[model samples]
Every structure is written in structure tokens, then in C-alpha cells.
Target: MKAKMEHKEKKIKKVWRNMNIGFKSDLHEI
Candidate 1:
């Protein structure tokens, strides 16, 4: 159970990082 939660957190972290990069790039382009 603990391992499953850690796996989910890692997936979420990767998604969040990608979103942050996209947002920053869009702002810079504007």
C-alpha cells in the first residue's frame, strides 16, 4: 500500500513538472 502511494506521487510530480515548464514557456513567449 505504501509503495502504491509512492508510485502515484512520482507520476503526479512528473505531470506537475511538465505543466510548470509549459506554463513558463507560454508566458515567456507572450
Candidate 2:
């Protein structure tokens, strides 16, 4: 169970990072 939770946390972090990058690019287009 612990391992599963850790894997999910990593996935969430990766997705959040991608979202942050996209957000930055969008801001630059303004």
C-alpha cells in the first residue's frame, strides 16, 4: 500500500510540473 501511494505522488508531481510549464508559456504569449 505504501508503494502504491508513493507512485501516485510521483505521477501527481509530474503532471503538476507539466501544467506549470504550460502556464508559463501561455503567460509569455500575452
Candidate 3:
């Protein structure tokens, strides 16, 4: 159970990282 939760957290972190990167790039475009 703990391992599954950790895995989920890692996936969430990756998604957030990608979103942040995209947002930064969008701002640069503007």
C-alpha cells in the first residue's frame, strides 16, 4: 500500500513538472 502511494505521488509530481514547464514556455512565447 505504501509503495503504491509513493508511485502515485511520483506520477503526480511528474505531471506537475510538465505543466509548469509548459506554462513557462507559454509565457516566453507571449
Candidate 4:
């Protein structure tokens, strides 16, 4: 259970990181 939770947290972190980069790029473009 702990391992599963950790995996999910990592996934969420990665998604958020990608989103952050995308937003930054969009802002820069604008």
C-alpha cells in the first residue's frame, strides 16, 4: 500500500511539473 501511494505521488508530481512547464511556455509566447 505504501509503495502504491508513493507511485501515485510521483505521477502527480510529474504531471504537475509538465503542466508548469507548459504554462511557462505559453506565458512566454504571449
**Model 4, span 1-30: residue lDDT tens:** 999999999999999999999999999999
Write model 2 residue lDDT over 1-30, tens digit each, in one string.
Answer: 999999999999999999999999999999
Q: Which tens-of-lDDT digit does each residue in 1-30 have in candidate 3? A: 999999999999999999999999999999
> For residues 1-30, could you state the per-residue lDDT of candidate 1 as single tens digits?
999999999999999999999999999999
Summed backbone clashes in each candidate are 0, 0, 0, 0
> Better model by TM-score, 2 or 3?
3
TM-score, candidate 1, is 0.93
- Candidate 2 Cα errors over 4 Å, as ranges: none
Cα error, residue 3 of model 4, in Å, equals 0.3
